[model samples]
Target chain A: MSGAVPWNEARAQEIIDAHLGLEGPALPILHAIQEEFGYVPEAVVPQMAQSLNISRAEMHGVVTFYHDFRHAPAGRHVLKLCRAESCQSMGSEKIAKDFLERIKLEWGGTANDGSLTVEAVYCLGLCAHSPGALYDGEPIGRVDGEILDELASEAQKS
Target chain B: MTKIYVPRDMAALAVGAKRVLAAIEKEASARGETIQIIRNGSRGLLWLEPLVEVETPEGRIGYGNVKPSDVPSLFDAGFLKGGAHPLSIGKVEDHPYWAKQTRVTFERVGIIDPVNLDDYVAHGGGQGLAKAFEIGPAKVIEEVTKSGLRGRGGAGFPAGIKWKTVADAPADRRYVVTNADEGDSGTFADRMVMEGDPFVLIEGMTICGYAIGASKGFIYLRAEYPQCAEVLTEALEAARKAGWLGENVRGSGFAFDIELRIGAGAYVCGEETSLLESLEGHRGIVRAKPPLPAHVGFMGRPTVVNNVLTLATAPAILAKGGEFYASFGVGRSRGTMPLQIAGNVKYGGLYETPFGLTLGEIVNDIGGGTLTGRPVRAVQCGGPLGAYVPPSLFDTPFDYEAFQKHDSLIGHGGLVVFDDTVDMMQMARFGMEFCAIESCGKCTPCRIGSTRGVETIDKIVEGVDVEANIELLSDLCNTMKFGSLCALGGFAPYPVESALRHYPEDFRKATLPAAAE
Candidate 1:
């Protein structure tokens, strides 16, 4: 059930065979599956387990442990907000509070509207300047309460 | 043929990297000098920003902080073949400022072309990863433990112990997550390494994948580092194409892969557990420990969460041998740390040095004192969440144990200098305010305590219930530190207390005007 690639049996075997007999190879297998199918499907778990001679629970555990590894489908747009000390110094806390309230979602919580999913990020090294936010992985500088509202509204559109 | 590196960091650009690049292109064409113009990153010698290099009779000759207008004069001084220019700081090795630094982790960061794989190989870049891969998993874990590398991402947990947990987990499922969520203030070391020598990160990650038996890795990169993210993506692709990141790297048949997961602006996510939750497509809040990420992390599998800088240093450690890496630092804290010097400083830049230097030396000598050329009133080592170090503590040596003795922790090694003009009142409010904003509101201490602290500080500054408010603010800070779940709440008062202690006058009411705490 991975995006366009379609996680059929043959591709699953290729991913399994790819990481054979290597030094601790869970991450490598995960990377291939993620690449082949935008997300790791349940079906591929058994294949991976069979291929690695491990249990499906083991594969599931590995898949779930990484925040970056997605088992289910993800939306097109991913927005991240700064929660570091510098950004927080510039009133990012208030900005985030109001923005989340407006969107009615917590940090890292995806919108039911399906337009965007917002998450929290730590220092991005833009600290001398603060109250930063990112839209679709693009870091925008000079964020304030009003600016956050505007940005969230923009994300709502996409 | 003479060789030189043109640094491409922002500080270098501000001084004259762009103009120097153009000049080099023009002059190299006109003179037919086979000058290799590699746009490398900074060597962390900031005052020497826009620094140019010349492969000379002696090693690479560096011109400190070159200006575009001064370029012609440098070339005229017979600098083409590394002749001595007036601005030349001599051979890079001889410079006392650079020579003093223990640049093990940052050895090839600013020197090599970030995208050039061959360059990465020539400088012994992937040697550590190669060695690590050759040694197998158990040996890699043992090597990490032997080196005594702690989490550079604030926690300072043993990297070996973390790996061993994952290695020994009963479930066959496992993961290696690189925490690129570097949200501390005054920290640019992560960004610098990401931009300067991206391949090192890739190689480092590959080594992690190999050791943990992890087949896939994810760098939860912050969105603010768009340039870094872009370059990293390109590097991953290049690595994959060359079979370095993809299946069967180095013909070892050890399949490994890496990807970038962009972060939303959330500071709490810098915490490993929060990062895992965020990566799992949920809110970036901290999970209660006991389970720890090693046992019930990510998707409830054994997992290893490491900092970008920490992981990036792995390949180097493996390549050089554990003993060599362990020998650099002071005592229990081993290896070099990248200390970022920022704010009101003449030479505000990043300096990589071994543990155990004094705060005074770093702020005054290496940074060349304050940027305004005035007496430095306060120095904030280790980011905003870190303590406000006073001149009295100037003799305090840098290292984990040393800082712990002084009632502070080195959180990401960012050193921000402030002149006497800084107000403790505003600074205190900032500390509370920062936590208030970034707090995931997972607990009461951070969520409400921060807001309460701000009001208390504001009242004291305004002269209303001044004595009572100070007592209340101090009391609140203690509770937060004691009661808060994460550093976001616990360490929030470091800057506040340090600020209040050093700059009491700034927080005094106009009516009382008492300067001493």
Candidate 2:
């Protein structure tokens, strides 16, 4: 869950300033910004580049290159279903597809009411417990339709 | 005081270990019982998690799959004193799964409090670093070289030679970089080592720093493993406080400190050069070889990069001597591998044993076959890029060369099993699609060829010129294998090629319906 506070430029600067001392601080700075703002705000990309003495395109490239760095703020909660090999073998694809269809959503889609955002993750390393997911940073294993429905309902309620 | 153990591992928590912990505390309070609960790492018996262990006069008795609801029954049965119960599986050490593992790298993972410095020392943790200091830098490299230790990060490159290159190279400063970006499916050994026994990795990295004369180290952990990141951060701080890290490690007057760097979700960063690029806060694109990461890396300095498992095993090799480790596995692949058995398996978990075990032994005997009670159609021996191994090739030993001989790999020792109902055509298509999505786009063959591969497979499946498309697909695979800059494109064809070679029936079955129509 993120977007608790609106995007703050001053706070983003403070986050950028703190990490600028370290060698190769771009990724860490981006991570901190996302941690506070829920996503890497486009407005702050140029700011970060200016501070780090790199071009905006370079900063944007770095941010966009990694899948974890979101452009817009996610919903109040995020549900990342594993679509990797292990989970696929255990039927995660069907589980994910059914749940998305039931919710009238697609992969990386945020709900209309802004309750949940469903995304596809390659692997969470919970392979032994295949068909696993991370619901707001908590790993849920052996995920089925019922579990997904329950997770969705819980997210909506919260 | 009666002591009870509950796993704090992510897999344990995923299946409601947190709820179980709370329930146990509530139940203990209701019964007016005083209990000492220690949160330890998983025993690698994943199917039996939230495995609750009770320290008895005889040994640690185990209970499998203990839900929160099952807590009261466990308490009523007097499980504190290791009382008899239906869920009880006897002493955990005596369990068939526990008994089978050699556990060189994972010896202390499930046995001790992961973050506690003293618990680490009590369980024989720092002995390797002490041994590293005693033998000095060159001798440490010599020991690792003699151990025949290869990179556990899928490539199977000799780790000692990599270190020796970094050490001998001329540099103002050097670095010990650990590629902890464990993105491969069916692999969690890196996550386990970091979460279970962070000290072992820390110790191993320190040994590398000591050997290579690198004062600084960085562990580029993946963003997916938040728990590992948390545990590793805590472990690093603890190690620093204990004089085992930072300036003057263990009063040895050698300055070696480790900084934890979290990777953004990029699978290619698992590759050494791309990892170095990611560390530099840039786009994670592959670098050409010749001046490998060993010679010049991480801001143009000599770097010693190794996988978590490879580094974690270093301490044991130094302490016990290389020959002790060399004696464990088959030819070329020395020491034990913590093979992760996952996907559709009955007893899926981490199994650490010597090389040379047949694929049949692992799947049928150790794994107890498929979880669905169906025949295993195929098992992908490595990660997503690994070839689909048919049942006919089940006799293939779990060695690097043996797997390579079959156009398969022992990549990170992760085996994702598939049941008989699996569609090989779909699996092959998914392999190409995965490559298309994950390709770093540094090379043409991987970036463009993978998408073409998907289209070609789709055409063949739809009965549209099947023979011609198959030929096209094979040619496409050949080009990607040889033309790609790195393994992302280079090895993406393994599953596709293997599926076509072994399971042509599935592809034909799909085509037959369209052919009739």
Candidate 3:
């Protein structure tokens, strides 16, 4: 688990206000809020709903529907392992299994020290160099267990 | 000062292009040599990246698979003067992979500075929009129709017909939306276009807007391509400043502008309706289509929704006249398709060719067969939803109709090869599993049937009533195919069915008696 920051209403309002005038601003607002705080704070949902003139249920639904928007803050580093067919053809499953075992974490699990979060992404569009991964938004291609271990160790150090 | 070119494409960056650039910069500074380093886009020859190029009197000299450490040696070997080295690949265009390609949409991708408007114009960018303005909207539509250009996205719907419908529709507020949500695993053509030559996309969209009388356009880009989004944003700004994209574009009094919208990770959103839904700030759920996007789309107005390639191909069609593009291809598929060759292949990259090459040619001659050095077992043409064609069917031509004859699709023209080491049963299971994971949960057949398909495949793999489970899986696939809302569920059966039909031996392994085993 990652450390949580207390929700700040003013910051949420600022994010909402910035995107309020745009056509269909709900997704952008949520994205901005997440970018700023690392996750969509629960308290900000109703504020967003009211600003967008939609129901709280609708706002929550929007946030929950997209896999990219997180309800909670991620660990220090997020490692997205591509689980799509291209990566699978290049032996991503074995790499994924070995990395999970080495880190003592399952898919979508955070490390015990909260230094790393592992998630399954459909594709990173790096199929030409398969077994792709994204470590903190930087794509790593032809990934192996050793590479995953190196990334994990670096995250721990950070 | 000598000019050096290195790609800033994500794939290039992935394989240490940044480090290569840094090394070159450091070496130059240390030697007190002034060399202009230009960050270009990948030439789609991914195996040779980070490929460095130098402009010479003999034309551009190329080096491939260069490393940061190789930079000092490269300098020592007089690479600045285009001297021969171990990594020297000569002229990049002379490479067989590049030479064979029919690069219409991607002509300017690796050659020009991506964000520079003047560079784009110099490389024959605004000619299409200019031609569209000269001939007017109806002629533009007629020319596109004459070109026989179909949607480069999966469906193969005729592009001109879709435009004509939107153009004919009476609406106060019409819109053009580009589906840049390239979620297919073996595809990166859209990403390359946006990052490498964004103005082409802009030009294409502007042409669409002009033809359809639409004032606003939006590119719904996937969130994974942050770099592409940045490049596009910068390009949009540059284009606006240069009077190519803003109000009164090209001083023709045709006001049109594009806004960039980002998608929050959903594979099904690649489907047009779901893309529209996501664009409207909602969950990317599939919508039933009696009222197609062409008739009624995007906030309940007549809108033209096209894939990135479909739109990007427009500039060429308008510039050279539609008949010129139509002349290149075979059968119903006109012009060239950008084929993304990947997975377990020796020479994996983008290969744009006319629609007549046999699969054998692509896999053996072009790709040089499997990277694992094993005999080729199967090749999955298109994306995850596409069929896994057996080696026996390698004679099938690389065209839409030819692929359809094999009960497969030429979706986004993505080809992922598999060596003999692959297990077809596991691959089938993965198809169901991927569908289950990414289904939008709108229709029951897709959301529920996919999960059931996985369970049935599991039973087959476990040898628990294997034959019975196979029948059940087949039945489930049929239900999903007919009953699902969109291609996400409808085409999910292609891979599963193809795998089972082609490689029955892999599936039968679990069913062998214990003693026989």
Candidate 4:
């Protein structure tokens, strides 16, 4: 997770305005908003819809349809473990299960202390190095239980 | 100064190539050595990554799986001059893995500085666009048609036919969209092309624009590929600076530019219409075909929608002429397919070869069987939607028609091997579960049928009227197969049906313990 600042209407508007000239501005606007605040604030939905001249339902639908968009702020650090076939073949399920159990956190759950959030991803495109993960968007391959625990501790310390 | 090559490919970076590079830099400074470190792409020999190569007088010498701790010792062993070391695999091109590959699309992927336009030209990049100009748009399409190059995006539709459709469709403004939303597991050829050789794709898309009279293009890249996004962004800028993009490409009076759009993690967006919808910044729901994308696509204009591999191969087909590319493979499946070998295999990596090798050769010989050292039981050809092939069908040749004949597909050329310990019932259940998770939910058959399939499998797993549940599961699969709106629901039954047909014992075994209890 990035060091996302607190949401401000001025900042959100600036971000949205910068990308409004693009052919398909909705996704770019959403991505920029997420990048700035770490999550798309629900309050900005209507604001964006009005700005783009689209209906609120249409804007909300665009936001909710994609899996990448986050509804709430993530923890300081994020780890996405692969749940696809390639990773599954290399015992990624056991790795994920053990890590979640050790941390007492379910998939897509954030730590109470806001140290880290663990999420399930389909694939990280590191199939050749099976059982891959992305820790704050940095790819980690051949991931095992030990690696996950180490990453968790590292996140907490940082 | 000695030149050293380190892969900036996602797989290499994941396996600590950055750390190795840092260690190398630190060690070099300590030893007062002058060296040029070129961050190249992976050669696809992933089992040996981070595969460091030192350009020696003899050739580029390889050091396989080098850790930071080994960096000092590598220097001590005179690795710069291709000196003797335990990790040394000699000249990398001489390795059996590298020698056996028939790289056409990937010819320059691991060989060039990805973003460097001059390096791209040196490695035969711009020649395709030059040839396209020489032969004219009609002849360009003719060459592509004659090459027998089908869409490597699993559809296996002729690329020439689709290009021709977009070309013939009369419109004031046409669009060319490259589907880079590679959502398939056990596959990364598209990512490799984007990250390793972005210029090739740019050139390929440029040729398509010239042939189809489309000045504007968009690449719908998946958001999972953050690194590819960065690489392609830089590559696109480099292209524009060099007049390869922008108004009047390469001094030709044609205006073309490519915009990179990030997909919001939708697997169905890999489908053409869904991709266009996503590009238009909407919910990536599939559109009904007939007004086909070629006829009304990308803002209701004529469009050429092609996969990453299909577009990447265009430059080569145009440069060498169609017949040269057509001579490689057997039957209709001409040219090389970059078979992404992954999963529980010992030597897992990308192997680009002509379509004809048996599954047995790929899984056993090329892959060196299972990494677990267990007997191979099954191999999942294509993505999650693909069928599970038992060891009995290992002799089947890896081609579109041949695999289709066996009720399986050579979809996207992804081979995910499994050891004997794999539970077919579990895999079958996962098939439905994945579909249920990824289905666009526009059609009831996919949205509802997938959920029903999962429950039916679970019922059979729990041994609750096992025989009846099995029959019900098969019947549900048939409904989903024929009744669904798109391939999502249509092909979702493949894995479920294949597992039930071949590995009947595993399904029965799941019920046995529950029945005894």
Candidate 5:
């Protein structure tokens, strides 16, 4: 009912039922759950499995298999850094390493203050402007340390 | 009223197009001038993004790399009247990057309002469908076959042959599936088509449906492209409202409707069988082929799975006839390929050119060399699964066959350039690491072999048993190449092998023994 839907059995069931009629509803249903609850709560999986007429193992497998599905709530701002070939050519590896070391966090680790979570994305399709990063799902191109630091500080403020 | 065009393509938006659009609006309001603002798709020349165009007496006069702050200045210079300004790049089509391009598929991209059905119709949109209806299904397949159009999603299988097989195959139900899960690193052409000119994809898919006797269609889109998904949904709704799609499309009595299925961040899903598996609500795992998707696909019914470009180009092939389309290409690679130049290149963008141009021309001449102004070292053609080409082999023609001869591939036509500063060993390790990370665990060689590859490369980097480890890595690559079920593992060796062969110096330096030192 609130802006960020809290973990509720009724809400999860509603989301699962909304997509159950589709041909392949597992991924879509999972995506909808994440969209609604910020993350796919472990509690919601069983409910979704039950509604879809599949076992809990099958539902859990689908959830864990894809990289986009978050098992836990991400920080207020999620930073998806591109570590693929195009980005690497423009010094993304160093940028990623330096940023992680600066924040004292590793890949997929949220900052202690809950301001940021850094995840490695294969590519953002912004190859022309390499060393790209997505700040809260909006892409930022030609990324460097200064830009990343500014973004992190801004995220902390928000 | 003066009409101004600003791209809503994600790449353009990434570089402050929204800000520029707002600024233009604000500046216009202040001057009390009435102007029509059109949100079009990008022209694919990404280096000069936020490119704003104004309809002037001369033509659509262009301004490159316009920022929010420049809007007021542009207004002051009477840019609406095509007055000279510092940012003016003249007409967009006259730009050298655009002029030379043979834009068959991308003719309408960045030029028209993406969702405007009227604009699409005005610019040779429905002609393909009209032509397809006139020729009938069998003749449509013949036209596509004669055009020599191949799958643009890396594998250069002829599109017509695939369609013919699906058409001839006896099935109770058939479906047309577009592989819009474009997860390749240096590729964005599919995204461009889906966002900028979504109706073209719709038209192409609908034509495919008519040709193959399919009544249902689906676009297996990636989740990363939220903009494309939104635009495509809007476009599909509009097409349905206009009777272009639904139970009876364009009064032809051919019942066909398309559904959009979003993928949850799996690169392997770009593979056809894996895509079908994902479409069916299962894990995005590779399936062993022999019964290709054309024969047994999408709920075990015959399905025609095609890339966005391959489908989008269908309209032109139908409208202009197959021979006209086939006349542009060299060798077996017919029609124009949208070569996406990316990474450290100066003029990194999409260039749709005919095959037969040497790789050197694409990199040195058209690309204008590295962005760092350093000597070019390596270029990775195609996606992550493609080979790393050294400067020595830059002369190889931009053809599928030519790249194959050099143990490389033009997978999806994405060229990622690297300067001399790149460490080949690091790049090679990344290839194995990426494979390990994205492998679906469907095949043992892909899942385990990729992990072993990463470990072996790490050992090589750590100078552990140097020569023996290299030998082991090669052996592992061979096993994966021969034993793997899909291209995910089979072609993973391309980057590793190419990197090692081309830049042995980097490997030797990383793994040199202390005794040798």
Candidate 6:
């Protein structure tokens, strides 16, 4: 109740409930556990290995296999600037560079202040906004230096 | 007693739906108004998102893109009593956009509270499943096949054919994997449908299981989509609780179950084979084709790997009958697609129309042109991997064949519009760089070629060996296309090539010859 939704007991049951006695139910079960808890915590990995009757290495392999699962806590805001073709076409390289420099963060990294995490997302479905970006999860288009500045300010207020 | 539906999907929230929800709740109580509000999905009318549908005796009246302050005036206008507000498109059901769209797949999306199962059921959430129980599995597959529903997730593979193959495959354990890893730039239709009508996805997979004689399913959703995943997990549990899923679904002597599989963070995993590999506890890398998942996939068993929209469309295909779906399209592509319209445009959002609508109509008519109010430059159909089309191809229809004729494909139905200010060279480089970063490092072409492609383009941008560097970059993109094992490496060059061809001036202008400069 207090923290990152606890990767503990309730999550353990969610994992247990994710599978049946069928062949190779480990993957689906791991996915379910991670869904309940944002990440497949180091603590839960061992628990899942035991519950799914697989090795911890196997569980770790799974935890690393797909790109959707994450281990670290997301910053209060996840600022995904489109590093895709269209966005990059309209000076996204500069925008991304600016974002990295301004926030003092690299791609796939969070700002030390924990206010923002900058990730290089491919696209936010706003090609017209060439150089698009998503603040938290909402997609915004036509992102220029000015727009980025406005977004940076917006994120700070939240 | 007034009933209202507010969209609680993350998109609506990002645009201040949270504050609006509180306003509606607080104001209704303050005015001592009796209001029953349900949070549904967007009406694809995103310009008017946080779209509030107040129920009337005939149907729900629309009022939205609302702000917290707008609630006072809206209340005064008898909005709490489902009266016509300024934003109200009286008799919301009759709106041309909604009326024209034969939304069998997305029927439950904008109508009911996404997280509320009671609302979902009341709106006929599991009706297909109920009907599925009465008919045999073969009959269900027959209906889907008759519908001519192609996979909406980029590749226009025949959905019925895929199901029939999996259904008839000789395997002890068949698996059904829904590729919900929607990483396309302009494509939120997958996420929107998943978050709005999760039960449709559940019912779809269950029906898929019954069709393929598989007992289990996995929805390999992207991790970035936390909200969608959360709702899906809840819906999965809800389905199990309500006997819509779990052992012997519908007590029809057929057992099937589904679980949400969260992908770590790979865009290439959106590909079916890579998705299958990722689901099977390996790096989200693309697997070789020919053994095509249908014959052998997801743990060396027969598996049906499909897109989220493809699976979501199944329930309706069964409920309304396949012929009903097949009648709507222009060419080989049939049925309605949830077109995700985003970016610099006045009218940006989802438009669920039948296939065959021209790119011109979608961009100029529905999108209301560019947000900058300038003449539109180019529209990128599909995600990063899709092709870029110039204004010349604006008149082309949106079906797979039509797009393919234009050297494009409607990948995931995300149409991103750009104005005159865009440069094509940088866009081309991004295709290479993105593939480079997202590549699983399995093969050389995609893995190394992408990095080189980025470096080569960087040289051009920096005005170093301009023309030669451009040729080298183009050559590298071509090699990556033919030589790479998968589309991650192969098809990435599509955007790069198309950009270079359509807007040659953009690249030449930025990286002009030293003599020209």
Q: Rate the local accuracy (lDDT) of all candidates.
A: 0.76, 0.92, 0.90, 0.92, 0.91, 0.78
Best by lDDT: 2
DockQ of each: 0.11, 0.91, 0.78, 0.86, 0.81, 0.34
Give the per-residue lDDT of model 2 (tens digit) for B404-470.
9999999999999999989999999999999998888999999999999999988987878888999
**Lowest-scoring 10 consecutive residues by lDDT in candidate 2 chain B?**
B506-515
| Per-residue accuracy of model 1 over A1-158 as CA lDDT, tens digit each | 11347657897787778767544455556667766876778888777777767778876665654455666655446666766544543456678888789879887677786666777766556443344555654555456667666765676665
3 or 6: which has the higher lDDT?
3
Model 6: lDDT equals 0.78
lDDT of 3 by residue, A1-158 (tens): 33445578998899899998777888889888888888898889899989988999998888988999988888989999998888888899999998899889999888878899999998877888898888888888889988999999999998
Q: Report residue B294 deviation for candidate 3 (angstroms).
A: 1.0
lDDT of candidate 5 over B1-517, digit per residue (tens): 9999998888888788989999999999999999999999989999999899999888898898999999999998999987789999988889999999999999899999999999999998999999999989999999999999999999999999999999999999999999999988999999998889999999999999999999999999988787788899999999999999999999999999999988988999999999999998888888889899999999999999999999999999999999999999898989899999999999999999899899999999999999999999999999999999988998899999999999999999999999999999888888988999999998899999999998998888887888999999999999999999999999999999998898887877754556586
TM-scores of chain A, one for each prediction: 0.71, 0.97, 0.95, 0.98, 0.96, 0.78
Off by over 4 Å in 4: B513-517
lDDT of 4 at B378: 89
Higher-DockQ candidate among 3 and 4?
Answer: 4
lDDT of 6 by residue, A1-158 (tens): 01346657765766565575544565566656655665567777777777766798987876775554567666667777877654554567787797578767788786565666777766544454356667765655556677777766766667
Instruction: Give the number of colliding residue pairs in candidate 1.
Output: 35
Model 2: what TM-score for its first chain? 0.97
lDDT of 1 at B322: 79
User: What is the clash tally of candidate 4?
Assistant: 0
* TM-score of chain A, cand. 1: 0.71
Report the lDDT of model 6 for residue B488: 79
What's the candidate order when arranged by decreasing lDDT?
2, 4, 5, 3, 6, 1
For model 5, the stretches where C-alpha displacement exceeds 4 angstroms are A1-3, B511-517
lDDT of 1 at B486: 82
Candidate whose DockQ is highest = 2
Put down candidate 1 lDDT per residue, B1-517, tens digits, no spaces.
Answer: 6677887654465455878788876777777767777778778776677788877766788888676677777777888777777788888777776788778778887788888888889998778877876789889888888888888887688888888888788876677899987767778888888878888888888887788778888888864676677778878888998889787988899988887777655677788887887776555778888898888886788888899888888887888777888988888888888888766667767789888889999889888887667787777777768888878899988889999887788878888777766666777797898788778788899999999998887787678877677878888988998898888888998888877777776766554644443
Grade the docking of candidate 5.
Answer: high
C-alpha RMSD of each candidate structure in angstroms:
8.7, 1.1, 1.4, 1.1, 1.5, 4.0
Residue A142's C-alpha lDDT in candidate 1?
A: 53
